[model samples]
Target: MNRVLAFDLAPKKDYIEYINRGREERIGTMKVSDDYVRQCEKAKEIQGLWNPDVGDWIYSYGSRSIEKVFGEVTMRYTKVWLPVQEDLQAILRYETPLVMLQAFNDWLYTDSGYGCVNGARFHSMQELWLAFVMWERFSKVWDGKDWKVV
Candidate 1:
């Protein structure tokens, strides 16, 4: 089976800001802002609309679980995307092929570990473009067609 996973390397401050924005958009019987609505629509396009409560629970409890899974899989796969700088470094210390995906305009994770990977860099495109390029390269090797698996 093909499995894909992602994490956020965002600093605590930036993560707090995003969570605060989500809270404000959802609080006190107020309608969400058009910008926030657009943002949510975009996220829904990618992750789909899980129930809000379930989504929040996943955000709260799923990160560590996902990390453990990623750690286990890193032993088997060459291409991996890591969110935290520490985890990325750990993976690289073992000489794994890792790609660090950063938001072009993000304040957090912008300068965290720019030179850690052998062929790593920031992705400065819309989310859809980022996903497209990632998969385009990944499929070639993962499907055992164009490139050799490591």
Candidate 2:
């Protein structure tokens, strides 16, 4: 089944790397875009088909507000969404559960013990810089209390 998802904007280098890795591993090329997302919303909006739930979904989809407000290059992020094929899905399904088991370890493993809540640990200044570059694009961050999207 197809599903809509939001993903953070990473660098061209990382994107290329991901593509390369996928190809080498027979994962196929990745497709990430928001054209379909925008098209769906536009179609619904034009038909006056929006409700609170639909409105919320559109607003939150792809971190649209965060990407627009934060501006790329500052944090260097843009939202991307794409389908996960069966081959890729299989790998993700197998790994997702096991990944959760190390949640505690991940939290304590970061070099600085800070960053995204999913608990990604940066091991180098370049990694930190890349994260800032990626995140600098998000308009707001969850300041532990509330979301400030401007």
Candidate 3:
């Protein structure tokens, strides 16, 4: 299988467990944005991703795809995907300060942090779960067209 993200630091079992939490529990109480719904639609469109016809394949393919973009996959029993320490570092390193600030406000300070231990790094499970959430968000803007540049 193709490795998902460049920073594949999390374990595979973690991704499976997180995704197995099912959709509703993973999204929590946050208002599901139009963007979020759009993302789910994108995933459903992928050929082998989330095949509803096959009971065993619900989240596996989507999990693989998520790993490709986000490095790992994870899920939390919450409304939004909270950024982990690695994600915080990554956003700061690769994104603008304003974007980082927005991520913090949206993730760190919300109920997403309710059961999380506040520390320099989050529990590995937490980090993986966030990756899955990000994957869903990333799917929203993804067009099925080839990604390669001519």
User: TM-scores of all models?
Assistant: 0.19, 0.17, 0.21
lDDT tens digits by residue: candidate 1, 1-150? 333333364433222111222232322122233232232233322223221221121122213111212112222222122122232123223333334333212323233222223113322222223223223333211111222222
Q: Which ten residues in a row have the lowest lDDT in candidate 2?
A: 17-26
Candidate 3 structure quality by residue, lDDT tens digits, 1-150? 222122234555333223222232232222222333333334332322221221121223443222121232233211123233343245334357687556645554444322223423322443323333343333222223221111
lDDT, each prediction? 0.25, 0.29, 0.32
On TM-score, the candidate that comes out on top is 3
- Per-residue error for 145 in candidate 1, Å, reads 36
lDDT of 2 by residue, 82-119 (tens): 22232212322334646633542453345432454433
Alpha-carbon runs more than 4 Å astray in model 3: 1-95, 113-122, 125-150
lDDT: which is higher, 2 or 3? 3
| TM-score: the better of candidates 1 and 3 | 3
